[model samples]
Target: MPNALPWLDAAPVLAACAAVAGFLRPRRGTAEVFLVGAGPGDPDLLTVAAVKALGRADVVLYDALVGPGILDLAPKSALRVFVGKRSGAHAMAQEAISALIAARAAAGKVVVRLKGGDPMMFGRAGEEIDHLKARGIPVTVIPGITAALGCAASAGVSLTRRGVAATVHFVTAHRCDAGATPDWSRLADPEGTLCVYMGKEQASAVRGGLLAGGLDPATPVLAIENGTRPDERRVSGPLSALPDLTAALGGGPALIIIGWAVAGAEASSPVSAALAG
Candidate 1:
């Protein structure tokens, strides 16, 4: 028989090269899941490393609060999954999300679990990390600007001001139980700055709790909605007027800042002395 053509051997070589590439390729991304922080609704806030990771990602699982602009950073081929979670509306259960992350990572794809604000804060990132670790999946966290700080900065207010705010407290306005209340005694302290997250619907209850705890009804309150976003809104009034102001303004992620620092920042800082009295 005539000698096989030289190209005949090329087929085997190409198959071997493909096999090696498959084997050398990561079972996941450079890391299993890159837990990236989407930052406070701005594409400029994205770190250089985060930008690179976004380009390499095969999938991006993002949250509701994460601005739509961050999606522009991801690779065109990447699969974008929206696990929208409002204060009460959760599309995917926590457990399901964890499993989904691990499953995607295990499939030899770069997985980016993009969350708004800092992942370690009120982000519930601990649960996801624990779940991934339990399955021997690698995970990494990238910090971003948290809402409290982000809102304060964008509003040109400081969360803690020397001689004005001696302490700062971050609390959730709405908890798992609607009727449950936080420690009003501590929250009532006038010396500290209070940052209430996810309290839009319970604005009245929040104001009432603070007032009942002996906080001045006229204490200055700054309500920032959709902080750091284009439609961001800010209202300065007394704690008593927060509910009405927020209701009138309508729509956005409402964050409440209450304390002497709000008014102390300036003699006439827009804050009302409780119900505009």
Candidate 2:
């Protein structure tokens, strides 16, 4: 009789063990999001952290400029969504993209927002971060190569040289608010290299600003389209010829580098010679 019900005596111990296990269990409803940089236009340039994040992503939100072959790193099961915006075409609005990211993350899925170039550099990461934080979603950012660095490397041009270019300034010709523009006068530093992002359509404004700011129109300038890609094109000339150079290329992502340091590239090379002035 004593043995028949003896197992019941351990109920308290078992209950305590259950309580400990419950305490150790992971909490539910937590959100996780990764803001990852896909580099300029080279899949090989992806950082290890970026690769890992993409591999484990349950959903990936990508930009228009993300390099080819980069998305292949993600698992086949991951949902790939294009959230990029071209000059005049937007696949998804900023607010809608943010809402979608937060919604996917809230469902307890691993979310990766894959962006072109560095997330913090003109990528509108702040707006997304703010949206996610307000909804209690945790965010992690992994940096990648910016367009200026990638374009310079592919063109064999140095953005900053020992004596020629002591500093480098990164500016964007496109603004979120239409009609608003960068202060080109402040950016026309003689000793610093100027890297213009999204300046293809605004090439004339860029040239005018630098010239008016007293930057020598003869300063060496290099325009790279589809930088670091197989179809990449390079045009090098004086600042006075920037607009024409930009116009010569097909509609593609482009970066404009202006400074004496650009002279480091072989302007006589076949790819750039015809446009080199």
Candidate 3:
């Protein structure tokens, strides 16, 4: 006849349930999609706007390069989907990823397409943007530090130094079409810094192209692996040694910096020291 559940005992259970409910509450936002840059590998490099967008994300579709620390910024209730692509293995095709984004947004969800590095730089964000725009979905973009800048800063290398590197160029070693190559002659500026992304596998090609294009073989080159992250490693040497230097780095997202500005930049480990010798 008396109350089966006492207030004190039931109070704790009810409070726990409330907390869970609050944590799992669905969020709605004005923008249907947010294209956020995760900023290399370091979570500290994430922009303020990027953080805010991630916080309010109802669904986050992230790439392989987006670290776990960055993804943890999203709400616990948000759906985190992996649509990342590595060299030979792709979790989801680009077309499928684009379609999923539109479908999620059309369902009235706040979708965040989280990319590593500045979304505009080699991130394929334009493709996603075009897809969303064609569907009339409102989207917002938040930029973050690109890998080149982050790696250069970590290595204490000034991409552009007075009387040295007058210009800077960012290029990718991998092309969408096989057997296609970038204009090496145009990129071989004596007074310019060249940063090559996704060049780990194509190190030999890069070295050969630059050499054939008449870039000074004695030019300094620095390869920073896992740049801006805790385990960051830097290897500095001549442009002729780019292939060996890159090979010593093992498997990791690396940025190859070529210019006089990176000549004397500090190397964290003996890999660079060995290469330099």
Candidate 4:
């Protein structure tokens, strides 16, 4: 007998067709990889693109400097992995972390290698990028606010002031190779501002080297800890006293600034009194 209802006549066949289409068009896995800068301990400083990337990340591989507040922005369902290197404590080696990112991306998982400050600014992002590229894993880099810039901004100090500093030099306190020593004589030039990353622990040594290189012992130096964070603290003092001031505040991740321009900023900074106290 002819079916009374045309729709019902083909219901079983229609359901089978829909099931076949669903199987053929299975949701494609998103294996996007992003090397995003989280900024220096301050989530507010993060770029719009960086924030969006974090929101989309399936798994976030973050560094210690990325801070906690920024991590909270990711979905609760996302996998948050800690592959960070602490200031004094050893953790997962950099190579292992890079390898992990590549492997995860290959597994069709969205990978976000979140770093503190600009990814290119001593974040070891170059190595990670190279590793991923070598393995044919798709990768993109997003820059973020660096610690030196953020610290200077928070302290109201210009890294380069007109007429005061025509040049600004950013150097890392930590040696690239275990035993390498930086040329302090060139770094101690009075014409430019010197911004030191990872130099808090070696405050005394850094001061001594600068002093020996003709940088005035009384030269103005500002040491900022947890720069740009809510607990941000800055201690301004003469180069010779930098170590003592840093120790007194209890050390955290820090950036050190030295120059005539920095010394000239004493009026706006309350850090001088904080250090004196």
lDDT string, candidate 1, 48-162, tens digits: 6567667778999999888767898888899999896886689898889999999988777789899888788778899999998998888878778788888888877887879
For candidate 2, which ten residues in a row score worst on lDDT? 20-29
Between candidates 1 and 2, the one scoring higher on TM-score is: 2
Q: Give Cα-based local distance difference scores for all models.
A: 0.78, 0.87, 0.86, 0.81
lDDT of 3 by residue, 72-184 (tens): 89999999999988898899989999999999999888899999999999988999999999989977788889999988887777999999988999999888888887876
Model 1 residue 92 lDDT score: 93
- TM-score between candidate 1 and the true structure: 0.83
TM-score-wise, the better of 1 and 4 is: 4
Better of 2 and 3 by lDDT: 2
Instruction: Output the TM-score of candidate 2.
Output: 0.87
**Off by more than 4 A, model 3:** 1-31
List the candidates ranked by lDDT, beginning with the highest: 2, 3, 4, 1
RMSD of candidates 1 onward, in order: 11.9, 11.0, 11.1, 11.7
Can you tell me which runs of candidate 1 are displaced by over 4 Å?
1-31, 264-277
The estimated TM-scores of all candidates read 0.83, 0.87, 0.88, 0.84
By TM-score, rank the candidates, best first: 3, 2, 4, 1
Residue 101 miss distance in model 2 (angstroms)? 0.5
